[model samples]
Target: MLTVKPILPRFGAEISGVDISKPLSEEDRRAIIDAMNKWGVCVFRNTGLDDESHIRFSRNFGRLELAPLRRDGKGRLAHRELFDASNLDMEGEINRDPSAVMYRKGDRLWHTDSSFMEKRTSYSLLLAHQTPKEAGETWFADTRSAYEDLPQEMKDKIENLKGENSLWWSRKLAGADISDETIENGPKAVHPIVHTHAGSGRKALFIAAHTKDIVGMEPEEGRRLIRELIKHCVQPQYVFKVKYEPGDLVIWDNLCTMHRGGEFDAENEARDMRRTTVREGTEPNSKDDDDPFTELFTGMPKSLSRLTAPEAEA
Candidate 1:
C-alpha cells in the first residue's frame, strides 16, 4: 500500500515508500496516478534519481516532451536544468555567456508550461539537486481556487471570454529576436479564460505569462482586463511556497496551477534542478485565429524544421 501525506491543506502531497530509481510495480504506479488525480501536486523525496532515472520515472506518467535545441541548446540533453544550484558562483551570479538564456534575471513570473503551444503541458516534474542556506523557494497558486474565488459577476464575464496566447510574447520578454517563421507559426492562439478539467470535471482559470490579449478586444482594454484576471488567479490565499532540499522531487498539474520561482541569492549560491514536461493535447476555444504563427514544428528542433539553417553550433 502507498503512504500518501498532504503537504498543504489545499494542495500538494508527499508520497513515500516507492523507490523511483527502480521499476515500480503496477499497484504502486496505479497508486501514484490516483494520487496525482486527487492532489494536483505530488512529491517524491530522496529517491536517488540521476538524469536517466529521472527520465525513466517521468516517462511512467506520460509521453515526455522532447527538449528542443532552441530551448535547451544544440546538444538538447536528456534532462533540462535540474541540478545542484550550488554549482553557481560564490556570488550566485549566473555566469557562462553560452548559458545565458537559462540564467536570465527577472521577477520569475507565474506561468504554466507551454500554454502558448497548441499542445499544452499536462504536468511537470522537478527535482531539487541543491538547497540554499535560505530563500529560493518556488511558489504555486491553486488556479482552481482562483477561479472559484472570482466574484460571480467576474465569473460570468470570463465564462465566455477567450484570450490569445503565444510563445513570441514570452520570448520577446526574454530579449530574443523572434523569426518571421516563428511569428507566423506561433501567433496568438485562443483558449477560454476558464477551462474544465478533462479528468475531474472541475473548472480552473487558464491564463498566464504566455497570454497576450483577449480576443476581439482593444489592446488597452484587453491588457487591463487580462492583468486583472491574472492578479485574481494568483491570490496569496491560494498560493504556497516550496522550499527546496537536495533529493526532493515535485510534480504538479500544469492545468490547474500557476508557479513562480522564488527569490534566492543566485549570485552566491547554486540551485539546480532537472525538469520534465508531459503534454496534454491542445483544445483551443473558438476564435478567428489572428495569430499568424500556427505550425506545430516550425521553429522547433532544426531537425524538424524544413527551412532552417544548420542547428546552432555547440
Candidate 2:
C-alpha cells in the first residue's frame, strides 16, 4: 500500500517507506505521480537515493532534462541532467551568491520551472545533499489558487491574451550575454497568461521570469498590466515556505506552482543541492514553440564554464 500523506492542506505531500533507489513497481510509480498531480509538490524525508539514483527516479515520471548548464559547480552533479549549487563564491564570501542575479535568483522569483523553455519543465526534483544549520528554505505558490482568486474581468482580459516569455530578457536583467547566435536561435514565444493543466483540467497562472511583455499589446501597457497580475498572483496568502533537512528530497510540479529559494547566510554557512528537471511537453496554449532544447538554452553559454547570467554582470 502507498504511504502518502498531506504535509499541508494547499500544496505539499510526504511519502514514506518506499525505496526510491530501486526500480518502482508500476503501481507504486503511478501512485507517486498521482500524488504529485494532486499535491503539486511531494517531499521524501530520509531519502536514500544518491545523485544518479535520484535522476533515475525522476525519469520514471517523464523524460528527464539535464539541469541547466549555468547552474552547476565543481565537485557537484552538474554533468548532464544534474546541477550542483554547492560552495559557490560570491565576493569572496560563501553562500553570498544566493542573491546573485544569475546563480540563485530563480528561487527569489515566483516562477514555474523552465517556463522560459519551449517545453517548460513539467516537474522539478531537488534533493538536499547538504543543508546548512539554519537557512536555505524553498517557497512555493499555489497558482491554481492564485488563478481562482483573480477578478473575473482580469481573468477574461487574459483569457485570450498570450505572453511573449523570454529568457533573453531575464539573462539580460542579470547581465548575462546575448550573442547573435542566441538571438537567431533563441526567439521569444507566446503562452497564455493562464494555462489549463492537461492532466487535471485545472487552470494556473503561467506568467514568470519578469516577462518582457504581452504578445499583441504595447510594451508600456503590457508592462503595467503584467505587473498588476504578478502582484495579484504572488500575494503572501497563497504561498508557503519549506525548510530543508538533510536527506530530504522534494519533487514539485512546475505546471501548477511557482517556487523560489529563500534567504540564507552564505557568508558563514554552506548549502549544496541537486536538481533534475523533467518535462512532459509544451502546453498547447503556448504559441510558436519548437526545438525545446534550443529554446531552453540558446542565450546561455554553451557550457557550464560560464554559468552566470547577464544580471550578474559586474
Candidate number of the best lDDT: 2
Write candidate 1's Cα lDDT for 197-245 as tens digits.
7755678888877677788899789878988977887776777778777
For every model shown, what is its TM-score relative to the native structure? Answer: 0.78, 0.80
The local distance difference test score of model 2 is: 0.67
lDDT of 2 by residue, 1-314 (tens): 67878766766788886888888888888888788878888888888888778877877877666443343333233355665545554332354443342445444565566666566678788888767788688887778878888889888888988887765565554454446355435666577888897756788888866476888899899978877877776788777777888778988887888777777765578776777777666331233423354335434544212444212100
Q: What lDDT would each prediction earn against the true structure? A: 0.65, 0.67
Can you tell me which runs of candidate 1 are displaced by over 4 Å? 70-103, 171-186, 281-314
Candidate 2 Cα errors over 4 Å, as ranges: 68-75, 87-102, 171-186, 282-298, 301-314
Give the Cα-based TM-score of candidate 2 against the true structure.
Answer: 0.80
Model 1 Cα displacement at 208 (Å)?
A: 1.0
